[model samples]
Target chain A: MNQKTNISQIAVVGTGVIGAGWIARCLAHGIQVIATDPAPDAEANLRKSLQQAWPSLEKTGISPGTSPEDLIFETDMAKAVEKADLIQENVPEVLELKHQVLGAISQACRKDAIIASSTSGITPSVLQQGCHCPERLLVAHPFNPVYLLPLVELVAGEKTEPAVLTRAESFYKEIGMKPLIVRREVEGHVADRLMEALWREALHIVNEDIATTEEIDAAIIYGAGLRWAQMGPFLTFHMAGGEAGMRHMLKQFGPALKLPWTKLEAPELTEDLKEKVINGCETHAGNKSVTALAAKRDEFLVEVLQLAEKYWPEPQSIMKK
Target chain B: MNQKTNISQIAVVGTGVIGAGWIARCLAHGIQVIATDPAPDAEANLRKSLQQAWPSLEKTGISPGTSPEDLIFETDMAKAVEKADLIQENVPEVLELKHQVLGAISQACRKDAIIASSTSGITPSVLQQGCHCPERLLVAHPFNPVYLLPLVELVAGEKTEPAVLTRAESFYKEIGMKPLIVRREVEGHVADRLMEALWREALHIVNEDIATTEEIDAAIIYGAGLRWAQMGPFLTFHMAGGEAGMRHMLKQFGPALKLPWTKLEAPELTEDLKEKVINGCETHAGNKSVTALAAKRDEFLVEVLQLAEKYWPEPQSIMKK
Candidate 1:
């Protein structure tokens, strides 16, 4: 087994959006990656994704190399897990599939290797139940376009070992992520649950015709969102009070606390509502092809990340400022 | 009466945060302003505020000049409104005070002059009822530090003239603002109402102990907020669907729409809640003197505005890009 101090190699199982993004980010950070998927064209698709990500990463000075040919692709899951320091599973969200894949990988990998799932909503303990090496399994969920956005929620299962957790955290940092350890496993982790709340309200507003899809969007992008990017809501409110701070604002505005909110529960996935949502999104996005939109998004993401990086530099460089 | 195409002389009543910010923004755009307040040290405070805003405007090449010497300050309301093409009132939120000031300013200013309120919640119609030339009275509500943030909500009362509305829009555009016309009268207009929804939820979360103020903030700033600054929530979701568009997203996640939200109504100004809010805010913003915190906020605001300005240039310059 490779010692803890040696440069780590990561195994990426599944070659979908999240999986491909993981491969791209890890390779860009000079970590060797062993990527595996069952689809006949998985290797080609992964290559295509990396080719698309190159320009934006280059613009932001995060391109790890000239090519991703250094990345190894394998068809066999067991082979992919062999000799890997960490395994990041990004397969379908189905619990059954997760159990089978994780069980196989855990049985095949080095005993000390840390295993993580990129499942957004599911609990780690539930997912790890079938794994023989459950102590090594946890959730290391990352947002879309992982190469650009710098946040990962490191969630530990009940059986996850402390050392494995530490190793996973260190490895995430090595690949340029700001890993936040979620103390308890909750549905949707931290960010997604908060997002779900706002998203539910947004849907309700659309359904109720209080605002159109576009108008609701306009309210956010042009308003509080600008402040939100730099500071959290609390800090924004704290600032809103001028010198008075959050408490002052809460006290002053507290009287209106019982106002009705549009925080609707998750609407039933009725065919009609789904149709409205999908159509609304299509109309709003206009003529851009999926590839075009993704590329544009990646480019903008690079710019935003670069801007954020200036304010929040690497931990080492933070002290220098 | 000056009927020329330009508005040269303007009056800013009330030298508070919003009022001073309006003065700074107006003067920076080369419109001469006559500022008035009843406080004994109003002139000194205005000067101090202007001095604080100078460095930022200077950096952006839109500096309004070094001193408020160009900004004439007067104790007498009529003297300040005399010969002014426009009057922007930013007094306290009390209705009686607003009525008194609007009545006095209308009696003093040119018949063609537009009277605009910076009130966040009060309707323009309510505020304009006391004025003789109600057609000229409207709301030109702006966020704090009006010079740096681009959004300005313009609401016309029932009696507001179309000509006045047109002129107000043009005036706001000329001063580097993204002026949004509120087609209908609403209590908090558009932006504030949406903000109040989220703010109300935030208060509930803090009061409920689901999350700390800091953690709730972290969830936003680090996650959804970054996307919001560039695009609104709907557009971001549209992009998330990877070309399937908003329709795909709404369809996929249309269920779970009725989750209970912590959307509390505005809390009553109960002494206990009031003290909690006050103490919570002070604790969150410990030790940073109000002036020092304000200065820091101003510095960051300048940077963010500059960055956003690059993406959204004056409409004319956008063609060049």
Candidate 2:
């Protein structure tokens, strides 16, 4: 059964970076958004963030009848979820907080309304623990600057129903998003776990002073990172193996895996390592602040993704495997 | 000592994909190239490859006085190396063949002429063995479509002189390439090691039937892979850590790494896995041939890199860190 009609409106709880981005995206897609946050100055700050992000969305061309003014700010939790077809919980990553927030939203929204959490680490099963209807609760994790990047991992908890996942996927697609459904509820889901592996190795490198932060980034931004933006490692190796393909590459390079090459054990983030890591990033930052760097990152991220869409066109066709 | 007066011309041996790419980039840079290969149709094939690659290179703005006619082909190894100031060897990965070709090229070129090998795995130390003026031998490994990607890992062997490395760096910079000088000899250098780690993990996923090749690619292209193009894992984590930074993230996520999240062992490439891998790529590739995909890849690569250059502006400035 289609639990709700069209996702004409969205309830966004916690107006932090992720939540605000979701609000901006929904509003741009012509969905009325009721966003709530208890923090002081939350309304003013969120409006600023939305104003900053709106231009990028405008470039992508927002839905008809959509405007930043479509966003409604609410401090009352019950009022926020009153008329939403879907509610996305973007509370802090603490489990108890998510449980409380998700429970409240589930109780207030339509009995059939789907509730999704943006928790990156905690499994949805745990977040749905005290909700009114756990079957309607699931995880829909989006990358930062959520308005830009299309990847959103949708993890259905053990209690979550299959229909909710299908409906959520369709709704996300409606909002111009690519939703990857993780079959199993592993910690960090699929994308974050993969990100964790490389991140840990990166920490080890900086910890031991094998390379400075700048050198490490250079190795990627110019080399393997370029290939990653368009394809994952498997298809790249298939291409790199010349005519013989992946089998030949595996046979020849398999032995190196056993080498003590990349450190899996993350070195302690001691004060010394912290200074080095921070300083290295500061140097790379040059004259810009983190905010400036983030602005620049958002700008490039959109351009690169647009180019990727133009080149690959149909990410879903590739995801069909 | 200045290794050579100037890099007026380059001698390219082996007309494989890597070699042809090198020729195209050089010709586009307005450098005269004496290219040699023994394959019966080497000239015709090289011309066809260059013709296909020219449009992309032209968009990058070809150098003044550079034309496709500048590529001179020779079947005779000594004649090819006679007038060149630099020799780039792209022979097959076999050790004996590399030794034979590099030694012959060294004997033919001027004593101070720099001879660089484009070996992906083999270390420069072994390639220098039995070569004339072994001090000039070094590994300048480049990514595929060598013309488009700015990364070139310059590895110095035991016998390679320090000044040769400096001169090579300057020469490559003048030609508009980013060369990363490896501090010590290592198999696969830095870039390939990172690529290999991710690749080995990808193979495991497919082998276990956890995900198809396309699914694996989707996990990356739409997710973490996008982050990689501009920032590596370290800085990205720095941002992900919120106001607390990398230490906070490491403390939060360190324990998850101990779990078997990503496979360290390279899965045996069984026939079943190979068929699955190949089939996934073919489907993703759709109606395009490998050559067609390569063309599409090249077009987007140049466009994306140009966009990246515009946003980042000075990869060299960042590389300075």
Each prediction's DockQ against the real complex:
0.14, 0.18
- lDDT: worst 10-residue window of model 2 chain A: A312-321
Using DockQ as the measure, which candidate wins?
2
Candidate 1 global lDDT: 0.66
Residue-level lDDT of model 2, residues A52-119, one tens digit each, is 67766776668876778878899998999978888998887777777787878877899878898998
TM-score of each: 0.74, 0.76
Give residue A34's lDDT in candidate 1 (0 to 100). Answer: 96
lDDT of 1 by residue, B159-201 (tens): 9998898898878877766677776776776666666555545
Candidate 2 TM-score over all chains jointly: 0.76
Off by over 4 Å in 2: A1-5, A129-132, A242-321, B1-5, B38-41, B129-132, B241-321
Candidate 1: regions farther than 4 A off: A1-7, A39-41, A62-66, A94-104, A125-133, A204-212, A215-218, A256-321, B1-5, B63-67, B94-108, B125-134, B200-211, B256-321
Q: How far out, in Å, is residue A162 in model 2?
A: 1.4
- Give the lDDT of residue A81 in candidate 1: 92
lDDT for model 2 comes to: 0.69
